[model samples]
Target: MTTDELIAPGTTGPATPTRRGSLRPLLLRLHFYLGVFVGPFIFVAAFSGLLYIFTPQLERAIYAHELTVPVGQAKQPLNDQVQAAQRALPDATMVRVRPGDADEATTQVIFSRSDLAPSHWLTAYVDPYTSQVRGTLETYGSSQAGPVRTWIDELHRGLHLGDFGRLYSELAASWLWVVVLGGLVLWWGRRRPAKGKGRRRLLSWHATTGTWVAIVLLFLSATGLTWSQYAGDTITDLRAALSWQTPTLPAASGHGGHGAHSEHAGPSGPAVAATADQVRNIARRAGLDGPIEIAVPSEPGAAHVVKQIRTEWPTKVDSAAIDATTGQVLATLRFDDYPLGAKLARWGIDAHMGVLFGLPNQIVLAAVCVAVLALIVWGYRMWWHRRPTKGGFGVGRPFPRGAWRSVPTPVLIGLIAVTAVLAWYLPVLGVSLIGFLLVDSAVGWAKGGPAVPARR
Candidate 1:
């Protein structure tokens, strides 16, 4: 049976009355408009995210020569590896070093290029056992992501258009939850299925699939928003003001001695402070084990910051600060001591990136991405089938004039308050919402009333 047959005659229009005082119609209008307008950006994000989760496999295959080595009889000292990396890049300054995760893995000796941006660095993969320089590659950002992973990550975040393009992603994330919840309400209030399956099947599939992925979609939207540029900063500042910031070792204040500028010195230069071996000893005393990251001190009296992050479920994130010259442990912070907000932020980011549960996490997130793509495709298909033959493509209908007047006063007030808060919380989303409302109001005024569908 057709959808037209399934929906009652008068109920097909936006002004149709219900117990909820036209709430369903308003939500339907919102759902339809957001889906039609925002669906493309969501599709791009999901597709790029799908590609990003496989980065581990892609990196392993593409960089095997640089990342792997045969298990050798004895491992070389950390400083020896650093010296080897320095010999390879004679002019570059040492940045940090990452211990290999396993016997067959190569240690990373990172170096900063004076000519490049501060965030850009070159990483030399050195065999831990033989101190042999395997290869070197330039990386970007704090995570030091390689060329391929960086490219994919940038595409996912900003389509490689930089900060300005980031708004597209933030916009998609902000509206995602609204569209999902609105979809749920519309599906629940939909008419009963007609006698035989036909056009009704489209609605059925769309609703069913939407319901199936609704919870996961919400989770993704919330977590994705936390990483957005503008919204993320607001969230961080809010959390900090609430005393929810993650605890970390305090920086050393006064310059303890000479060699404070060791980080700026070339690899061939004299040791400015404590050697890598001494810093490693200090980190060991602070209970950091397994693959660790040591950031070289960049200034006098600065501490050598050491961090260990395990990518499995129940992640182990711990860090310590060691006095660069004295090789004394300055401070240590463990994951178990993180505040509630900090823990949530850490776990959410890791899970979103498919690192929280290891391979299983990656597989599940990849499936979600696939489902999102499918949902977007089906949504567009439904819209295309329902679009009017004459007019340019648009959301089919909007609530009738003054339809909002029937909404309960309290509910209306609550919505307005929430909208105001959201706008304040995420300025970009707020601006976009205001723009949408302005355009919607202008069109309604120009047309003499809110636009309503021509009933089939």
Candidate 2:
């Protein structure tokens, strides 16, 4: 759809007053407060995300000895690499093994312990060719991010403040689309002088930058919402109800249970009668190949899970559960057979994480982040310039009140209805929007309430 379709039309004429309109004034107020208040959280998320996207290369340089090895004539067995990792961390429960498919890349054997934070584990990097354990590091999340990326990721996800801190990001994500769409509508709905300085210039930059990156911002906001605490949980429940979640191979015995190893995401299953390499070979023969991970069963009766890890476009995430004892493939789930929603979710997530197109994906993500940052900067500049300065000192004056009074009865009702439904789907957005309105109203009341609309 075109940008015009994505945005509702607003008052169109010279930026100067042609008629008093409710929608544009209300949008201006909402947009202003969102940028002034929630903007910092968004700034942090964007800046950290920008840094996190490029950490794959940063990690390689910083941990070369652990991440890479001298090329050998041929690689050793996955079992050998797992053994080396086992020697290094005998006490930890084995989670999964990632056999670095690249010539000089090291095999990564991930282990989990009760002491580690949820979804955080120890990853022992081993030389596949030498069966030597290079080193171990605490990795985070499904992507197995190293220290540098993990630090930035933690900042982006929750500012390293844990669960409570996550609210900030969720709040930012929840409001981002409104900010984006509102900015688009406002920018497009009105006309500005061909040339101006100060507030006008800032407005031009902010609107143009926001419009240019509008799609990316919306995508980022939506995808990022899926990772939030409140909204994410709600969306997850909705997905499960619709069976839109990514399909998984059943455990060896067909029994299902999660949490055996948080990172693996495979159900509890029957005991394995074979090694990781054997199961991996089984999956390979079944047509799964290219950068795969083998999750060792944590609980007895759990089968080995071999799944493709490549997240690039045309995702190769086909997974299989193997009964190593019987050498039988218990179950298989192919990307092609995934439900439509699941497929889109996968692609959206991969693109959001900057792995869908490799380097180009990273570049685009970085550019979008810079654009967002610039918009925030320019927004504040506009707000600053718009502040009352009579006597050379005053606070910023918000858009005149009573703008909502000009809204048509049907349009206002429709807007409220749409917002309510969206709030149900995205609770954070609803909660924050209410909170802003109440606070703004209270402050205005305390200051003698909204001023009477001025006549042109």
TM-score of each: 0.87, 0.90
Per-residue C-alpha lDDT of model 2 across residues 306-408, encoded as one tens digit per residue: 8898999779988888877677888888899999999989999999989899999999999999999999988777656655455566555555555676566
Q: Candidate 2: where is the Cα deviation over 4 Å?
A: 1-22, 192-194, 252-258, 263-274, 454-456
Best by lDDT: 2
Expressed as tens digits, the lDDT of each residue in 1-456 for candidate 1 is 223332333333433343444466566557767877888999999999999998978888899999899999999988888888888988887767888879899988877766765467788999999999999998776566788998899899999998898999999999999888988877776666423343356667777888898998899999999889889998889898988887766653332211222323444433322378888777777888776777776564577777885756767778887876777787778888889998888888888888888899899888889888888887777655554555555533433444456567777789889989999988877998899889888987898875533322
Error of 1 at 170 (Å): 0.4
True-structure RMSD for candidate 2:
4.9
Q: What is the TM-score (0 to 1) of candidate 2? A: 0.90
